[model samples]
Target: MSVAGEGAGVDTGTYRHAMGRLAKGVAVLTTTAGAQDHALTANSLTSVSLEPVLLLVCVETDARFHDAARESGVFGVSILAADQRALAAWFATPGRPLPGQMDRAPHHRAESGVALLDGCLATLECDVRDIHPAGDHSIFVGAVRAARLAADPKAALVHFRGQYSALT
Candidate 1:
């Protein structure tokens, strides 16, 4: 372990240390506002409730999806399969051109008209119910309108320490 503020280590050590201890599952968040569709890779998603089918996804304040989520008022979460490292990377890249960018990814419309990735382990269509302000991020509370799981079991893609990996 490195000490801080005594010429022992860099200031970035704390951030790296914190990330090192966290293990997260990767998911692609998709939303369409008007005629524009937006998708971003995210790991900050969690199930908030089972009784009413609620989920929470955090979006960075500056992310393209942040405003899209608010305007669209609906979104889809696609839990990426283990083999989808390329998809995860493609969505996570910053400043990529957007028109028909993800056309190659197999997708279908959910009940809410949100584009859901076809080969994912699971997909959830949700309506934005509440928005909470978190530091540097917005926590979106969504009520699940529809959900589906793949018929065949598949390993999940995971993200940790800024790397994409597979759950064993």
Candidate 2:
């Protein structure tokens, strides 16, 4: 008896549309290589193991952030607040310039040496614990070096149904 989720029968477009219903918090993944900084907007971040304090971010193979994350061996996650919609969209843009891109926003360095955007609802600094390639994207597992709550926490920014919304 084949189930509804069984292979080939599920079309990619349909699968994507179905998953779009999942409301997820939006985060900006950041890394630095030498003097250069790279970042990508990701909603694929999820807590993996509580004992080890691990989290993972899925990055496309061709994305610039992928290479930076691997090489730096460290990264930062800034959980955007509702007021940070513009910041989220800026980092999400494709083919944006690498240099001076970071200057476009206000941020500070985490202990892990990665940039953490200011005005976020929360922040996490992490050291790369492991990496696994899954299909078109690579999952980078991070061991939390430090986690912090905003000085004044605000509503979370969420992505659902191919749009960004405030989770108030």
Best by TM-score: 2
Regions of model 1 farther than 4 Å from truth: 1-13
lDDT of 1 by residue, 40-110 (tens): 99998999999988999999989988998899999999999999889899999898777886786889988
TM-score of each: 0.89, 0.93
Model 1 global lDDT (CA atoms, 0 to 1): 0.88
All models: lDDT? 0.88, 0.91
The reply for model 2, stretches above 4 Å from the true place, is 1-7
Q: List the residue pairs that clash in candidate 1.
A: none
